[model samples]
Target: MVDLQVQYQQLKGEIDRALAAVLDTSHYILGPQGQAFEAEAAAYLGVKHAVAVASGTDALHLALRAAGLGPGDEVITSPFTFIATAEAIAYVGATPVFVDIDPQTFNIDPELARKAITARTRAILPVHLFGQPADLAPLQAMCDEHGLLLIEDCAQSFGATYAGRQTGSWGALGCFSFFPSKNLGCYGDGGMVVTGDDRLAEQLRMLRNHGSKVRYHHDIIGYNSRLDEMQAAILNVKLRHIDRFNQLRRQNAHYYSERLADAGVVPPREDGKGVHVYHQYTLLTDRREAVQQALTTAGCASAIYYPIPLHRQNVFAAAFGGVSLPVSESVAARCLSLPIFPELNQEQMDRVVAAVRGA
Candidate 1:
């Protein structure tokens, strides 16, 4: 789905130098690189603080903990997202209230989410699926009216913006991932949580480091979730070129949309409320299996972001088996993501378009 090898070659010198510096210093944990990356990321996202974590899942898990969500609390989120979105709530002994997604944008429906809110609902966690920012205005207003926390799962969106503000800066706490395939990813597993609240930032910092502010003294139970120095160093180098990377993705996506306009598929729609970084150039087609087969025959790649909604998954089936979310189910059955990256050339895009049209 991506060409990491080519990207690495493009930044070989800088990445190698960053790695060498980290190795020479021998400060793998809580090192200068990680600290610097956190500050740089915070500045880029226009947030007050950013805490690096081991993985994107850890970022979400720790954010829920820092927000004081527990047993009886419920977090409203979309069922169309990756499993980790709901898993984080479950990790903190909180309930995940699954809701349907908007048909066009494929993000959590704000009206559905508001309807799902109950007395037990303590937070609304919105996922920016496929680097498209969710409609946060209504969701934020609903949260404010109910005095609920607003957390964002920005795992797929690194530099995406909504209403002229960055996605990670919209909510109380925003979580990001560096899973190598993301718009702004590192060499390996890395994640961050950005927030404007000072109290949440301190809690996240302590929670990531064994709940100790004074090194030895422990304040509460915490997990080992710090982002390693090597990964952080790699991220620092990549972060410098994130804007150009996103621009390329947007350009490539627009080209694909134009080519596929009459190719018997529904191109992704941008709501105009935000910038979509095109983490994946996904489209909806009734003939998904045939298109996938054609791409495979043409030596091109295509994937399904999610084949099953969260509420329908076996893990949550017992509790939510009877729940029905028609939109999520319908979209999951038809969505197919084509290969999209900053390095994608015209020849590659033409080949992909031809395969889809031929199918």
Candidate 2:
């Protein structure tokens, strides 16, 4: 799904220097490097605060915490996403109301989400799946009308923009992951929560650090989820080149879309509202098994984002046994991600397309 080694090699000098700096300081926790990255990230996203955390899961968990979600509350979201999106809700003792996704965008359907809301619904957590922003305006309006919060899972959309604004700036709180495969990844695990609300920002900071504004003085129950300084330093270096990287990804996406159309593979459709950063360049194919086998035989790699919907997962079977999300299930069966790293060459892309067509 990604070529992190090639990406790293492109920035070896900067990355090495950043790592050396972190080692010199010997401050690996919430040190100056992490603090600086937070500020830069906030500014880039047009948010007032960006709280760095240990992982994207932590960012989602803490964002829900900052939004005042708790036991028995429900967070309506798409069932066709990474487990972390729903897992964070479960971690906070909140029920995840799985809704069917829009088959075209592969994002939570606003109509379905609005229909799923109940008196227990406290928030709407929407994942910007495949680096395209969900239909956020309608979802945001829904949240506003129902007095619910809006949190964006932007783990795959670091530099993506929606309706002239960056994705993280649209929702009340936006969570991002710095996993090595993401658009703007660090060396290891790291994540961030961006928000414009001062109150929410302060709450997030406290919640990420044992609920203490001052060291060791616990005010509320919280988790130890601070971002590593070394990761932060590396992210800072990579952040400087994200625009160029994403531009290359966009170019590759356009090329693939054109070629894949000829191969009978349905390429991802741009919703036309935001910049689609082409995070994974996923395709929907009914012949997944055949296509995957063909690609493997040709020494090309392909992946399925989610082979099973959240509602069908064994862990949540008791709560969602009767739930029927046909679209989510359909998408889970058909969705296949191909090689979309920014560094992939034209020859590599051509080979992948040829393999899929051959299958």
lDDT of 2 by residue, 1-359 (tens): 67788887889999999999999989999899999999999988999999999999999999998888999899998898899999999988999999899989999999999999899999999999989999999999999999999999999999999898999898899999998889999878999999999999999999999999999799988899999989999999999999998999999999889888878779999989899898888899989999999999999989999899999999999999999999889888898999988999999999998999999
In order, what is each prediction's RMSD in angstroms? Answer: 0.6, 0.9
Off by over 4 Å in 1: none
Score every model by TM-score. 0.99, 0.98
Task: Locate the minimum summed-lDDT window of 10 residues in model 1.
Answer: 181-190
Tens-digit lDDT string for candidate 1 (147-193): 99999999999999999999989899999999999998987898999
| lDDT for residue 136 in candidate 2, whole number 0-100 | 92
User: Cα lDDT of all candidates, in order?
Assistant: 0.96, 0.92
